[model samples]
Target: MQQVYPQEPRPFVKWAGGKRQLLHELERNYPKKFDTYFEPFLGGGAVMFNLLAKHPDMKCHVSDLNSDLILTYVAIRDKVTEVIESLENHSKKYQKNTNFYYYHVRESEPTSQIEKVSKLIFLNKTCFNGLYRVNSKGKFNVPLGRYTNPNIVNKENLLTASRILQSSNLEFFCRDFETVLHDIKKGDFVYFDPPYQPVSNTANFTSYTSRNFTDDDLERLVNLAEKLDSIGCKVLLSNSKSKKVENSFSSSKWKIKEIQVNRAINSDSKKRTGHSEILVKNY
Candidate 1:
């Protein structure tokens, strides 16, 4: 496997709660070794890309409930050239009228896979704060960002990611996180980065999809983690530093640590940096 791209492959979209900032701490806590890797909450795949960069041939099973995100992965993995071309068209049209073109694409419902993926990337890049939020009706409702020049067509990163996806034995899914329980086996590593529990009343931004990841969902996730632990699967999880999260994994079987992280979504510069998140693992 020759490394063609000079840079490392990365996530194509700007996903909320993406782990790009926490990669170092995450690498430190990663299990010494495992047979395969599974990430049920595959937002912006920073951890997966980091692992794949080091071990290109590692078997990976990643999934997300956001169908559009999964479609972008599939499109890029299989049809990167087409996706690039479509994105270029978007880039051109966007320059002519940023606000109008952005909103038009946002309101559109493209039927083709390539079009849908390209539209998603365009919206992610041009949307406010690079945030992926939707209304209860499943419509992308984020307004246009203020970026004078957003990198809507990131060709180099996309190419690198596509090459990696083509070379690796990876599986992508658009399903509930709990579904992985049926396929996981002993010694497999599963890293869960579900939507963080809101620390404050004003911090609720879990609307990655139309279905918000609720408190009930978090409880189900805790149960799923325990089940994975009992099945002998190496499990790791990341979430906001909240009492609910801390108390849920308080059992003796888990190794809980608090790591500092920066919050990018907050509008206030004062509140944007120096936040704490919990990393729980069962080795």
Candidate 2:
């Protein structure tokens, strides 16, 4: 097999609130040397992918609570061919019965975790805006989007990601973010990108997947950052630069800096403008 290189170019999935733009800033602030990397709240994996592309030799440990999201990473790592085939089939089927899209989403149940993983990716590819949202009962509710050509699968990128994953002394798990603290030691770097505080009352979009990161969750994360800071491990976290958030970490030893990022989720495009976000770091 040909060795996969980090130079492989891949288009990112246009995810809501993705941080592809701020990756350079992250890289600039990241420590030049570290024993390992840990990303607990991996959303669309913009930071992780960028890190993998930049630091090909770095060992990584990544986790997320969403089973579907974690499975997509696993699928790319282990079952790329199967995932691509299923996505192509989904594209053909979706072209025919648009109504059946929601029908299958609500009714169909896969026998195994991988099958469910395939279904999740199928829906994510075809779903409106690539937004992952669920109803009160935790059912996917986003409608199909209008796109002439959707890269439902990217084989080369998937293969490259798998190769990077395989080469590292890596560990992937589906668990709560707080549990990750127990595994970190000195010289490790932890990057956190938890769901930001809602921009406004009507513009609330934090419900990415089923679990909501409440204020209490934010408090717990603050404690974790403090713990990591005390242990000599570098920690960098990002969140909305709201007054409440500032107060939440006001007493912490971490240094805070603000950066503006484009906000893409809103009914009116005019309202979807740049907003301030805080990058708390102890390096």
Candidate 3:
């Protein structure tokens, strides 16, 4: 297949805890080839896009509990021209009182699918540290980001992702992680990029979506991973190097590996680099 854009596909949205930094190490650990690729915690789809850009014909399935995020993916796949137009309008309106525009869009509850996705991508790029946090009522609360020029409409990258998403079997789901149970088969590769178990109390930022992915969710995830392992599916998971994370995957069969990653999106700029995260696998 011919590449539609000059640059290869990547995550268009600047998602927190997105795996852009860890791709090289992940590539080293990836299967030489696999039947299907499954990513349950598809944040910005850093890993998914990286793999998809290289392996366009690979059957890839992704999901997130964040419905709005999934909607943006769907919009990009089916209504990209409409989304691009809406985003361009957002770019035009943002020039005047950018701060006011940021909050105004944050508080919006758009009924149209294109409008909702445009607002989501716009806020993701322009919000503080590219953070996507919401309160109990699911209202976005992150402040305006410190950027002189946020790419409100990255037409090339958006179009590239949209084209890549137009693959024959590019599936998206807005369901809980364990729902992928029955579809997975032997020789498939499943990469789990769930919200990391906070290494420190001050570093916890699980509100990527409206709900917090607590330790309980991690437990459920571990059970699912084990199920996938028992059924002969190869599984890999990423998480903070915490005692809980260590204990959860301490079984004799699982292989735990640690790698360093920069904490590029922390609130406190001083502590925003150099941290260890664990990659647990059942290959």
Candidate 4:
């Protein structure tokens, strides 16, 4: 029998707070039609890819605060062939001696775009819990994850993502969430998947980049969401179902819905239990 493949493009990397699990809930709340789609906190790009596949004709723009993460997306979109070749090289050496080679690759930082993206993907797959976290000095610092086989070179998926990005209507940016403020217009559908607010004193995990998403940042996002709502734009946001997140949105215009999301890929199996997340939206 011939093998079957999915035409839907999914996230290539595993981000800490990716929304692949909650996409169904999100889609249910998504605006029926909008002029454009904007995702400010494009981490693993799970939601972005899903939206692109569902709305190929929708004009979309996605961006992230992490330079390296954005570089990986750009490299995949522009130079996928070169990136795949580099990943193949890394995968071959990694398979030889996983422990020894993992540390070697983690320590070296490549300057070229393709190499840098490949390195990021390699470290992500091999890193502890597939987390894309960085240190205070802005370095990839996650330890190696224990995996018999970590699909480092997912060539077909990468090719599919590249083709999706090749769409003339889709655009990507490497900047802070505030960058989209000036360009967003009325009738646009904006989805904010900012880092989750820590649910408890000991559950903080918002370190995707050097600059953490502080409570003040969440406040800023709330203000922006309100502004977007005032301007006739539709806004949907997801964050931890904590007091901080709940207290941030006070407008009657926005409705909040709590939903449980899978733990997905956490190092601590104990902490991998399903948790609550809120979907706040302005329709």
Q: What's each prediction's TM-score?
A: 0.97, 0.90, 0.96, 0.96
The TM-score, computed over Cα atoms with residue i paired to residue i, of candidate 2 is 0.90
Candidate 3 achieves a global lDDT of 0.88
Worst 10 residues of 3 by lDDT: 1-10
| Candidate maximizing TM-score | 1
Output the worst ten-in-a-row residue range by lDDT, candidate 1: 1-10
| Model 3 clashing residue pairs (backbone) | none
lDDT of each: 0.90, 0.75, 0.88, 0.86
RMSD to native, candidate 1: 1.4
lDDT of 4 by residue, 211-265 (tens): 8889889888888888888889999998889987787786588799999877766
Candidate 1 local lDDT, 1-283, one digit each (tens): 5454356777888887889988888999999989889999998999988988887788899999999999898899999999999999999999999888998898889999999999999999998889999899899998888899999998999988998887557999899999998799999999999999999999898999999999899999999999999989999999999999999999999999999888777767689888899999988
Report RMSD (Å) for each prediction in the order shown.
1.4, 2.6, 1.6, 3.2
Error of 2 at 208 (Å): 2.6
